[model samples]
Target: MTWGKVREIRDGRCGKGRAGDGKESGGGRRGRGVETGQSLTLQSLTQWKVPDLGSGEGSQEGERVKSGGICAERAIAKHRAQRTPISSKNSSDCPRTPRHSLNMGIFRFRLMLLCLIGSLSHLNSSVADEAEDISHKDADEAEDISHKDVHCGVPVNISHGHYEYLSHHDDDTYLSVIKYACDGPVYHLEDPEEAVYICTEHNKWKNAKLKYKLPECHKVSCGVPKDIEHGHFEYVTTHGVTSYLSAIKYTCDANYHERDFSDEGVYVCTIEGKWRNTDLDFEIPTCEPVLCGRPVVHLETHQRVVGGQMVVNGASPWSMLLRGADGEIIDGALIAHQWMLTSAHALQGEGRSEAEIKANFHAYVGIEDAREMDSAHEVHIDKIFTHPKTKDAMVYSNDLALVKLKENITYSNHIMPICLPAHDLAAPGKVGHLAGWGMGVELKPATHLLYVELGMANASQCLHQLAQKQPGLFTEDAPDLFCTQRSALEENVCRGDRGAPFVVEEGGVEYAAGILSYDEACRAYTYAVYTNIYNHLDWLKEIMANH
Candidate 1:
């Protein structure tokens, strides 16, 4: 018979029941105490007759509750197959009941059996449908999760540490499946309806999944110079572009280093979940020349002897010269023609024109008296060149300059050349002198031409004392300039003594050296910013050739 015909027969007994809607009347709840023996027998017959239906019966059975009921019937078929057959001879003691009574009883039993089978079939169909729905829902959720970690790629055979979970054993049983995988044991759980989640992978899930909601990173900055010593960083982009891994680490080149306190080359994560490297190398600038010391002079006449041996004078003949704008006959070695190499602040003055200086000229070298100054070389200055990046207006570490002289003097004891300091000689704490034609009393302006000297002070003492005196002058710039003061208060460079000479005595050879420059408010204290003549020799030479 067809599945439809069989269903019709069952419905005739149960009075027509639907599977999904649970709309079967009188088949549920009211007949729980009724005998289940007849109902089990009916299920067995249904299962036995299922295979006898048309081939299409399988599809029809799946569409309704018949398929699950068939399973139950099959389960009963085995039980029935084990029953023993009775012999006709032994049936003589059978009661002689009326045919109508017997038929009614059998019909009533069949009705009850059909109702019970229908109910069980309906329940099995409901469970199967629910399971199918759950499977589809799980698949959709897994798809969404996979899309989020598209960049992380497929998580293969990935195993995590210990985790916690909840499980519903049954109406009376509870379980706690802490770690479902791995060797972790399961425990007894209480709540059945609540969902169980493992918190062990929270951090991993946050970094890999939930963190995607963070802001998009445009640029990643490395190194917190203010807070860290050194740091290394590594990162990979999870957005639009595929397969992006940041290989560039933040690190300083050799001979150069970062001042950050973070460990060298460590990767740090930012608020955007991106990473940066903060490793840098400390740089060591190339060493240059040392331009310091005073120009040596003839002890008998105190006249400047230009080309001679002093300190920092390498084999080179070019030496730095510094002269006072005032009548002070302060001297220094001549390093260049276009640029007068002297103290850094020596040029701190109202640069005078050649005519203005000539008009107000009072004294000249080689002449004993102003009246007989005709033979003395009158060097006219045109422009003063001071370093642009000096420390401050008054103090400078790179105390040097380039003075444009209108008339170049031929080499002589009074106009001779000096040596330029090399790297070895130029260093901190070196001594130097300052000479100028400034007034003895700083209160008055510079007057008649005269020479004075002061010994070189140690670089450390000069820097320390100067910084104490002028709190703002101690910096990277001050260490480069040398310092000195007048040997005697009676003779010192005053206001107009700027651009004078600073010299020292050694081996009886007079060397043209530093320039006389800045002094404290009173003549009681003075400061001479030294010159870097050797380093600027080439720069001076190039400018002079073109000029």
Candidate 2:
């Protein structure tokens, strides 16, 4: 009755004959329907007795099969249960089939039922094994998917910027949001709208506004500052660093601001990456000189004059006196102990030969009064060197000359040399002074040294003005020549003003900024042109080096 260790005594298949031959075998023999231990069930269903019929003996019922070939066993060993029951009389009922026949039919039904139960048990075991394997496979696939869609961690850091997480489930998990900001006022985000990013479900950090792309942190750059006309700018934030939200200061050169324009202190690099003045809309400030009328100026009481004003003695120690034998006086600048700067045309006095002019010309320094030549130090000329490109024309472009003195002059309050244009910044529209003994009233030479103040005007405007008087004199683009502001006075520059030293004072020091190259007719609305000393520095340095 141990079902687990039961043996199959019938054929492996249900409702059939013996496992080998189709014959009915007798009791006491096992069937071959199944493997060894599976061959017997209920002890082969044979040793018990059935009701005897014709012979009053036990029939060979265990192996009996009907013509239809279905097994009908009627007897088996009931010894274990130790009980056997024969059908009793059914007197009133129709006569029953023989008791043995009835027992065989009941046995057959029980045998078939047991075979079916065994078949179902095997099917259930196979189904359970398959179900367990499918469950394990599903778990493995779920694990791989969990690894692939992992939550995002902290994103990469950006230069000049930082990020911080907003409300989220975790620091850098999915659906987390982060805000971006620049490191300082000197830097800005490239895109403000994209400053917030999200940790996406796809395990990536993405911009809040964009679907797939990651957010970017970019440092702003305000490229190179715009070029200022007649002026310059410098960075106050950092050297050679124009990027970020930096700052700058713009300033005009010397003489550039006579009256109109003024300085704007702080120019800043904006979030949009542009250089701009927070107060003004202009990107660059300009140094523009007024051409027609005199630019209004604030002059010191002692220095209020511009048209041949007489000053105290030794006021212009660097002013040189150049006189012709026929009493012609020309103004010059004393540059060194032995060197003097003048107009190249000064060497060509009207009536004197070149050799005679060199020998007879008298040069003096420390002369405030033209009439007091005896008190001035007279230096004889050792050599007369005019610029090689000097033109003896009405409008001289290279109207520069140097006179080498025979003796080395000593420096004193009344006889000092002026500085060369080296490191001297001559700003347009800034006033500069000129010292000379100009031709006085009615073509008479002045009895005292005179000086005048004039602004250094723009070269382009000066050329235009000068071209109206002498169209062929200048090409209007003279690089070495520069002009002064027009005088509103009746006589500002006259005949005796030629080669006068134009001194520009900066930081308490005086520099020889120009030499008078043109003389206007001593009338109102007249402007004079000069040779720019800065442009002639190379030639002067070359000459000084050679000497």
Candidate 3:
């Protein structure tokens, strides 16, 4: 028979027997129901067909039963084979009633449900932990992206200046320290406070506080004052936190006098971010003109003659000797009380220190005889100013220089200053007088004090002769050079004539028209070249006034 039909019949029989037993067996049946329910629940679990463990309806315990379904069925079949029929079974041998079977079934179903609930609980806990780990990873990745967007790329660039950048890990902002680049010119901020700029995560720059604006490289300038005439400014040094403090000194040129007679005229940068004199409202000094007179002797008395005649005693009073360490090197003119003019080549040498060159020179004034110095006034050389463009073996262009004396010389009838020519004195066939200790005939020793009258040579004829003798030496007619030929065939200037003045009388005043620069070998009909002092009058005056 079917198990359902047999269970119905068993229930009917238990109901009849329970009615016959009455109230006295009530407690005993209830106690036995619990014990039998437990025992039968265990057997039912082993024999029943397990449901398919699908979806949320089943658990790991149910899955085990489903996997062993065939084994469970075999166990149930064996149990049935050993069971006795209900019709012949004694009531005492099988005391479990339908009520106990019902209780056992309920207990088994409840136990399975509890097992399913526990499996679901464990699955949910695993899912929650995995989700938490993924969420944390996403957060870290987002933070990295944010950091890269904020501070990973290049910082903003500045022109004519530079900046320093600093970043912090916890902060989302970057700091920019701005500063000017040190180059052509330097500048400083008026305020002493520091300026800072902030760059935010959004890639925007903001100035925290700007007390003063930074100067552009092109705008930075040092305006030298122009209040003084015939003077110039010179840089000494610049110092300050922002390079705003500038030290400057002033000077005057040759044949000019400073107001205070001091060489040091220094100025410093003011706190107002301006360059000014240390003594504000101080009088702006000027370079005053120096008065000079003609020599005491007549020009006709110092005329040149054949065989290079010796000059009369004290006739060329302005003529002075440039004495080096060994002896006389060249001739110089007394242009002022403390200034002498000569050739730059006479005082300049290659690879020589300025001190060494200055130490080598001493001026001897009022001397007619080169061999005798007892009557000469010896003056120490303070400084030597050479022409800016004077170069050795370069055709003697701009061959000029000035000598400053340690002390002013006392003027006397035997010593005086000659006048500087105000206009061009170079003309064809014009005669000029030259005085120096140049070599005489037959390469003999130089005349004690020699004089020569030279006639100005034709420009074309001079250039032709120079090109024929020394090709490529005479390039073109220079503004500061003139050619002259001796009045007689054997009366030309020689080697020692360099730096001597070529004087020309104008209205009773002897003005220096030229200076002996270079000459061809001592031959008949050869021409000598002289530096045109008239063309450089302004330049000479300027140098004297500013130096």
Candidate 4:
């Protein structure tokens, strides 16, 4: 009465009936060719058959028979439901026998159930196998792509059969590649070739007979190299003064201090070729609240000059006064010995001759009189010393020169030495102001003394690029003179501002630090080369002693 026993009886009855029919008709097989399962071999098949139910006796065991029939039908229905057609074929061709037909209703139900379960298992295995194959092929492709012999573009996997090329005319290079997936549930790239063929077994092969015909590619024109414009600063090892051109140093504007780099903060041109301050502790920098020191001399006017740090006496005509050989008026640096610090270039080669310089030269320390100097300190042609390394006439070096005054200045509120910057004044982040009788923002001739404030730049950065242009300029032999260009193009010191004094507001006092040097013609910025007094304190004292 078991399900297995019922199937055996059904199969037996069908086999016997088929054999009898075959003998009567010529002993031929009637059922379609059925491949036996390994589990249900030929020997096992003989045992499987439907039992004959003799009319009355079989009816007496109706309940047991019914249960057996139900179980067989469920199994058959499961099978039928799960079985998938391998190919396009007629389902009626493979018919069930009469005994099988007797249980066909039940058997069909079991057949469907079996087929559903089998199909699910088949689908899962198929997906798993396909995934594995793809992973394996991808790994292989990665290996092939990594080979050094492979130039940028052409097809590489000629062996495994997948092939294609991509061309982008708008792009700078022909290195673009087109990727494609193979057919079927197992989509893996088997090969890269002219013609690729995939099989049912998930094996792909490239046909050797097919030759690739590439599409007509348009020529690509690269406008600029990506790195030059967007690349970071690259340090080209230079000898001597090459470091100055790089402009790698940053000094905070006056009132601003470097907190990020601590004491070691130095401005550098980044690899991207853009200049940035490395000394700022925060991402964005801000100018510190700088308290300008009380000038030894009080000014009548509270109006601020170009440099943000110092104040000029409003009562004096010298505030916006013009003097010197060129008849151009520039803001004067109030040095200690009653000498006004002006741009050496303002004197130019003309100052080299006393006759040309003395006749037209005039010095006024905020004097009321406009025509003549209040105290005409004999414009003595003492030693005119420029930076020993200064070479080019057009581009003067450390463009600074000192004119010794005939008399010591009185320490009065109205006339006093502008404070000298404390040693270590030019450390990065120290804002300094430059004043000179220079032309306005435009390159016109100097009308009056103009003053402008610019932050100190790192010596290394200015020299880095300049060093390349002129070698041996940024060496220890040359003093530690750093250069700073105008932060805003409109605020730069223009022509006739050479030899201007750079002063720092320290301890509420303006102190002279360096001299305006030269202008970079191509750029809106001008270069002010400052002599490091701290570095040459001993020399300065020695020179003063001789005077």
Model 3, span 1-547: residue lDDT tens: 4656434333332223421222233223211122121322334334544322322333453334333433343345555887844331232233323334444554676587456446545765798999999999999888767756564234344454454544443243434334334233353333333334555555555554543333333334346555567667666885322234667666555544344423246665554445555444334546554345444345454444566667663557788887667764678888878888987765564545568866776668877786665534787788778777676634567888888888787654456788898789889887878888767777665747878777888866776777677765564566677888766545788766788898887776788888877743456547887788887887788877976
lDDT ranking, best first:
2, 3, 4, 1
Look at candidate 2 and tell me the lDDT of residue 295: 23
Mark the regions of model 2 whose C-alpha exceeds 4 Å error after superposition: 1-307, 349-353, 393-395, 423-426, 441-443, 487-491
Highest-scoring model, TM-score: 3
Cα-based lDDT at residue 382, candidate 1: 62
Candidate 1 to truth, TM: 0.34
Q: lDDT value for candidate 3?
A: 0.61
CA lDDT, every model vs. true structure: 0.40, 0.64, 0.61, 0.44
Cα lDDT tens digits, model 1, 1-547, are 4666545444443222323222323333211221222234344544422122112424443323333333333444544786744433323333343335434544565676578667657866898899999999999898667544323211122132222333332111111222222221211112221212222222221212323221121232322322222322223333222121232333433222333322334443442223444432232112112222222223233324321112221222233323334543333335443345544443443454435543544323322122433435456656655555665445555555665666554432123344444342334444444433344442553333444445555656656776777686554344345556444433345554455555444564445445544554235565444554444556555656766
Comparing 3 with 4 on TM-score, the higher-scoring candidate is: 3
For residue 497, what is the lDDT in candidate 1?
49
Candidate 3 residue pairs in backbone clash: 252-545, 252-546, 252-547, 253-544, 253-545, 253-546, 253-547, 254-543, 254-544, 254-545
Task: TM-score each candidate.
Answer: 0.34, 0.43, 0.44, 0.37
- What's the CA RMSD of model 3 in angstroms? 23.7
Q: Which candidate tops lDDT?
A: 2
lDDT of 4: 0.44
Cα distance off (Å), candidate 3, residue 230: 32
Between 2 and 4, whose lDDT is larger? 2
